[model samples]
Target: MTANREIDSILQRAADGGRITPEEALLLYTEAPFHALGEAADTVRRRRHPDGIVTYLIDRNINYTNVCVTACKFCAFFRAPKHKEGWSHPMEEILNRCGEAVDLGATQVMLQGGHHPDYGVEYYENLFSSVKQAYPQLAIHSIGPSEILHMAKVSGVSIEDAVLRIKAAGLDSIAGAGAEMLPDRPRKAIAPLKESGARWLEVMAVAHRNGLSSTATMMMGTGETHEERIEHIRMIRDVQDLAVERGYRDDAVETGQEIGGFRAFIPWTYQPENNHLKGRTQATTMEYLRFLAMSRLFFDNVSHLQASWLTTGKDVGQLSLHLGVDDLGSIMLEENVISSAGARHRSNLHELIWMIRTADRIPAQRDTLYKHLAVHYTPEDDPTDERVVSHFSSIAMPGGGAGRKQLPVVGVS
Candidate 1:
C-alpha cells in the first residue's frame, strides 16, 4: 500500500526522477498497491511528456521468410529448413507487401523473419536495398541481434561488417524483435538456441555506435522468476546507460530526444497459445500492469515506453496509458510471428484513435523517431482517410497456405 513508508518513499523517489535500485524495483513490483503504483508511474509519464498526447505508429510487420535455424521453444512462427511450411517470399511479394503498406498510410515497415540458413548479409543487403528502392518513403526498422549474428556468420563476415552493409542497404534502425528476456534463466528456458543475452546487448551497442538507433524490448510471462523479470529490466537499463556514454549523439538535443541509442523500452507479455512451452506459465494482467509501472519508473533515461496491444489485447493496452505508456506500437498491416503464436487483437485507424481518446489522451500519429506526424486534439481533427488491416485477410496460418509458397502465415484465432 502507498501508506507503507517504504513504498511511499520509493515511489516518490522514482516519480521525482531519481533512479530506483533493482531491489527497490522488485519490492515495488510485487507489493505496491495497484492503483498507487500506476498513479506514481503516471506521474513519471506526465513529467516526461506533459503534452498529454499518446502516439501510435502506422506500419506493417512484413516477414521475408519463415525458415529459421534457431528453434526457440516458445516461437510458433518458424519452420525448419525445407519443411512444407518453410518459405522465402519472392521479391515480387515483398514489393507488393511494401506497396500495400504505403497505400494504407504506413510510414515504416518492420521487415523481420526467421534466420534461414541460406540468408547471409548479402541476402539482406539485396532485400533491404530492393525494398528501399521501391519504397523510399518507408523507414525500414527490422531485425535483432540474433538475426544479424546469423546473417553475419552465414556471410562469413563480422558483426560490424554485417551492420555496416545493412545500414548502407537502407536499414534505418534495428528492431528489438528477439529480445524475449534479458536474464540467462528465461533465455535458456525459452530460447536456448538463440544468442546469449549479453551478446544481444553487445549487438545493440554496436548498432548505436554505428548511428543506427533502436528500441529495447522484453517478452514477459515465459516462465521466468520475479527476480529474473526485475533483473531483465535492470540489464536493459544498464545497457541503455552504456549506450548513452558510448554512442549518444546530440542530433535532437534541443528537443531532448537523444538521436541515437535505445529510444524506447517496450515490454510485451509472451503469447503461449501454440508454442512448445504449451502455456504452462503465463503473466497475469496484474503482473503486466505492475511491469508497466515499474519499467517507467526504472528507465528514466529512456524517452518512450510502448504497450503491446497486439499481444495483451486492446483493453489492457488502453489501461497502460495511465500506467506510464506513451506509445501503442502499430496497427501492423501484416504480422506473422506473434499472431501465429496467438495474438488476435486487431485495430483500424479510427478505432485506435478512439481508444486513445477515451483514455483521455490526445491521439497522435507519430513517425519512427517518436515525432508527432499529426496530433488530433479533437474528433473533428481526426483523419478519416486512414484504413484498417483485416484480421482475416488473405494471409493464411502456418501449413494452411498453398504448397511451399514464399509468403507470410496469417494468424487465425
Candidate 2:
C-alpha cells in the first residue's frame, strides 16, 4: 500500500487540476482507498461539468454481417466466413432497423460487424450510402480502426483513403467498438489477428486528420495487469495531445462545435461467458469504479466519460454519475456484440431518465457530437415514448429475429 501522505498528495494534486503521471495513477489504482479515489474523481467531474445534467444517447447497434476472418478469441459475436452458421443481415433488414431507429427517435446508428473476407470498401460504401439515402437524419457513427483496416486491405487502398471514402459515403464518425485494449500484452493475447496497439492509434489519428472525430474505449479484465491498464489510457492521451498540437482539436472545447478527435472515453469491463476466456477472469465492481474514477482523472484531454450500464449493473452505472461519469451511454435499443459474450444488463428511456434524476442530476438527450438536443427537467415532463427500449437480444439467438418493431414496456411501479 502507498503511504497515506503520498496518496493524499497525489489525489490533492489531481483534484486541483494538476495532471498526474502514470506512476501516480498506478499507485492510486492499486493502493488508494476506494471511496477517497472516487471523491477525488468526483471533484474533477464537477469541475468539468458544473451543471447537474447527465447525458444519454438514443442510438442502436446494427451489425451488418457476422461472417469474419480476423478471429478474436474474446468475441463471441463473430462467426467464421463460409460457416453454415455465419449469416449477413440482408440490406432490407438493415434498412428496416434504421426505420425502426427513426420511429424510436434515435439520433445515431452504430454499424459494426465481422471482417468478412468478401467485404471490401464497396460493401461499406453501399451500406452506408443506403442508410444515409433512406435516413439522412441519423448520424452514421459506425465502425472503427479494425473495420477500416480490413476494408482497406480488401480494397487494396490506404487507410487514409478508406476513411475519406467512407466519410463521403455517409459515415459521420467512428465508434470505439473495436478498441478492446490498447496495450501490447493484453491486446495481442485477445486479438492476435488484429492490428498492433500502435497501428490502431495510427488509424484513429488518420480519422481525426480526415475530420472524423471518435470516442475512445478500453475493455478491462481481459487478463491485463494493473500497469497495462494505465498504459492503455496513456497511449490514448498521447494521441489526443498530438491532435491538440495539430489543431485537429482545441485545448478546451467550451462550445459545442467539434474539430475531430476523441470526444469521449468509455471503459467497460470484459464479459467472459461463452467466449474462449470462459469467465476465468473479470473485473469486480470495486475495480471498475476505481478504474472509472482513475480514467476521469487521467483523461484530462478527453471531454466526456460514459458509464456502461449494459456491462456493469444499473446500480454501479448510477453510482458512476457521482464518481466521474457524465454520461450513461445509450439505451442501446438493440445490442448483440457484448450480449453474445454473456452481458445481460438492459435499460429503456424511462429507466434512464429516472436513473439520472434519482441520482440528483437532470437527464438530457445528446446527439453524436455531444450536443444537447433535449433535457428532461421534471418527472412529469419525461417522454412517455415506449418505443425507446432495448430487447436485450444477443447475436447468439436462434435466428436474426430480434423484434425490431416491437415496443417493449418498461414498468415504473
Candidate 3:
C-alpha cells in the first residue's frame, strides 16, 4: 500500500482504540496532519476520561540539596559536591517548607534533588518519616528511580530494600525525574553519570512489585531522534505490560489498594538556558506538541497524559487540552530545578482553573493519586482561596517572593 494509505490506516486503528506498533507511532508523529493527529488523541482522551474534566495538582517541588555527584550536562540546577554554592536544606528548613506548602493548600510535595554523595537511604528515611509524622495529611511524592539507584549504591543495600525502606517511611509515590531520554545514545550523551536507562526501569519495576505507584516523565529536546522518542514510550509500554501480566492491577482491585505501576506519563521539553548543553538543538513548540499528541495516542495503558505548562508556556498548555492532554500538571507552589534551567512560565490556582475552563473543559483539583478532590464545573462556583498563589516559594526569583503577581482570569483565545 501507498504511504498515505498506510498512515491513514494506522491513524484509524489508533483512533479506534487499537494498539499501533512503534513504527506506526513514529509515522504518525512525523507525517500525520497536525489537526488529524490531535483529533484522534482527543478521542482517546475522552474515551479514557469521560468526565470532561481536566485535572491539575497543587504541589511544591522542594529541592533538598544542590550537591550532586552526577553532574548531568543538560542540567543547570545542580552544583558540584565541593562547590561553594552547594548546600542541602536542613531537616528543620525542609519541614518549614512543607509547612508552608500545607498552609498554601498544597496536597503533595515533590522532594527531588541532585545525587548527594554522602546522603544515603537513611537520609531519605528520616526526612520522609519526619515529614509524614508532622504532616500526615500531605502526600510525599518524592524521588525517582535514579535516586533510588544512587542511594542503594551509597547505602550498600539492594534497590528493592531501598524502595521498601522509603515507602515504609512514608514515601507515598515516586516522581519521574532524571528520565531525560530512555534511549541509550541520548541518555548517555546527557546524563553519563546517572544510572543506565535499563537500570532505571529495573528500579521502577522493583518499586511497582513492592506496591508503590509512580508517574513517568520524559525530557525532550535534548538532541534525541524521533525514533528514540518512540523507543522511550515503547520501553515504558513493555514494562507496563509486564506489570499487568504479574497481576499488579488485579491485586489492587482485590485488595482496595492503589493500583501498582505508572499512574501517568508527563513529557516536557529540556530547558537549555544556563545549562552545559547550551541550546545547540532543542525541540520546537510544534515538535513538543507532536510528541504530546503521539504520546496520548501511543501509551494506551497509561491512564493520564499531563501537559507541562511549566516548561511549555500557558498558551500552548491551553492548546494542549484539545491535542490529547487530560491533565494540566500542577499549580506548583514552589519549583526550583526547572526554573533554575530558565523555565519562566508560571500559573496560580485561579489561572489554571481559568485556562482549563477556557479550553472548554471542566477544571478539577487532583491529588497525587490522580483522584479528583474538587471539580469546578462553573466559573461562579470556583474556589476563592487566596493562599493558592503561584510561585509562593519564589525560589526562582531574585530576593525570593518578589514580583509574584495575581494572574487575571481571561477568556480563552
The global C-alpha lDDT for each of the candidates, from Candidate 1 onward, is 0.84, 0.86, 0.86
Tell me, what's the RMSD of every candidate? 3.8, 2.4, 2.4
Error of 2 at 236 (Å): 0.5
Evaluate model 3: give its TM-score: 0.95
Assess candidate 1 and give its TM-score to the true structure: 0.93
The global Cα lDDT (0 to 1) of model 3 is 0.86
RMSD of 3: 2.4
Lowest-scoring 10 consecutive residues by lDDT in candidate 3?
Answer: 402-411
Error of 2 at 90 (Å): 2.1
Q: What would the per-residue lDDT of candidate 1 be over residues 1-413, giving only the tens digit for each residue?
A: 46799999999999999999999999999999999899999999999899999999888777888899899998988999989988888999888878877877889988888999999999999999999999999999999999999999999999999999999999998988889997887899888888889899999888888888898899888789999998988888887787777747323433564456888888898888778998889999889989999999999778899998888888888999999999988877677788788876766677788889999999999988877899999999988764454342325343323222223323322
Over the stretch 232-302, how does candidate 2's per-residue lDDT look in tens digits?
Answer: 99999999988877777632245544458899999999999778888788899889999999988888888
For model 3, residues 176-278, the per-residue Cα lDDT tens digits are: 8878899999999998888888888888889888888888899989889999999999998888787777766523533576568888899998898888999
Error of 2 at 40 (Å): 1.2
TM-score of each: 0.93, 0.95, 0.95
Question: How far does residue 120 in candidate 3 sit from its true spot (Å)?
Answer: 0.6
With a 3 Å backbone cut-off (N, CA, C), the pairs that clash in candidate 3 are none
For model 2, give the 10-residue run with minimal summed lDDT: 392-401
Candidate 3: residue 101 Cα off by (Å): 0.8
